[model samples]
Target: MSPHPALSEEERARIDYLVPMDHPFDFRPAPEVPRYPETVRRNALSNHPLLRREAARHHQLPPDLVARLAADDDLGVRGLLAQNHPDTPAPHLLRSFLEYTGPERSHLTSRPNFPTEGAGRLRRPRGP
Candidate 1:
């Protein structure tokens, strides 16, 4: 039903845009994202999803960021970081997982790829 008797096709199109569409999904690819250099891109450590995902994909991210993500509040994000980060300290990460509590601990520990350096260290037990 048209809202106005005198509405033209263009006006009707404008009104359609104002009204929410029944289908909320956007199938179109995002337009023109700018490219950043590796140095500038390191700032993506902030918690935005797109930035974080982009940072996770960035090959030049530092080892420190990878190590820091072990304590990230978001387990899934942490897991992604763990999986993607290069040169992660295997023993340190496992120790951090042992220290983690609640759901984060459970999620991190459950990963099959979680570094086993700590386990290897424990098995060797020191002489008195």
Candidate 2:
């Protein structure tokens, strides 16, 4: 039986559309998924981390939602915003890089605006 039995067929379809089947670390959303700004914003504000994560992966995610998700309590939501959303601020990307040890860690470094010069300050000194 499905874990989320209450999910309607449309809800299940939305999940299937957003969640990639392969290249889990890829920044790009599924090309075939239709843009739905209202739905994306709704998901971004969802209390459930999984729903927030899905919203974070959307290519057309609204700027307001991006800002909101950047401050999300769930590391997964923040990390997905940093990884997938082009408009994610550098601060959020840096925070995600520092906090998330996910497979996409390296990719965050390559983002156009990801800060590099002062990154050494973020690391702790080795044992004396």
Candidate 3:
């Protein structure tokens, strides 16, 4: 979240109507959200979760941006990298990020990824 007013109240309100999807679930009439200023729209477009997710999928996303997205508050955004993004975070970093999630979110990290033997590790609590 911006500590400064990067978004006006009207622009901020528009963001509430926009939904970032991992995949489309249902179709609906696009809501009539207010338009944002060009600067706001450009900034929003660059950081849009869909864009971020796709960027995170690439091994070439700039390291700084990858690092920034690693700390993104949105779990899905975080998962986009944490779950084997080629330059996927190390096991320790994955633990640090995914630990915030419950079992339901584990599938994202539970792929044949991580430094573990199988996806089974994610479905069960880590052993001591």
What's the TM-score of every candidate structure? 0.38, 0.71, 0.44
Per-candidate clash tally: 0, 0, 0
Candidate 3 local lDDT, 1-128, one digit each (tens): 32124655555545644445444211122226633344333432354554444444443445666667677655555665555344545663455344545333544444334556554555657699
Residue pairs in collision within model 3: none
Clashes of 3: 0
Model 2 earns a TM-score of 0.71
Question: Residue 72 error for model 2, in Å?
Answer: 0.3
**Poorly placed runs, candidate 1 (over 4 Å):** 1-35, 38-43, 91-128
Candidate 1 RMSD computed on C-alpha atoms after optimal superposition onto the true structure: 14.7
On the 0 to 100 scale, the lDDT of residue 120 in model 3 is 59
Candidate 3, lDDT over the whole model: 0.48
- lDDT of candidate 1 over 7-124, digit per residue (tens): 5445544553232223221112222563465522443454333334445444345666665554555443444454444444555446545543333344444445556554565344
**Model 1 per-residue lDDT at 34:** 37
Candidate 1 accuracy as lDDT: 0.44
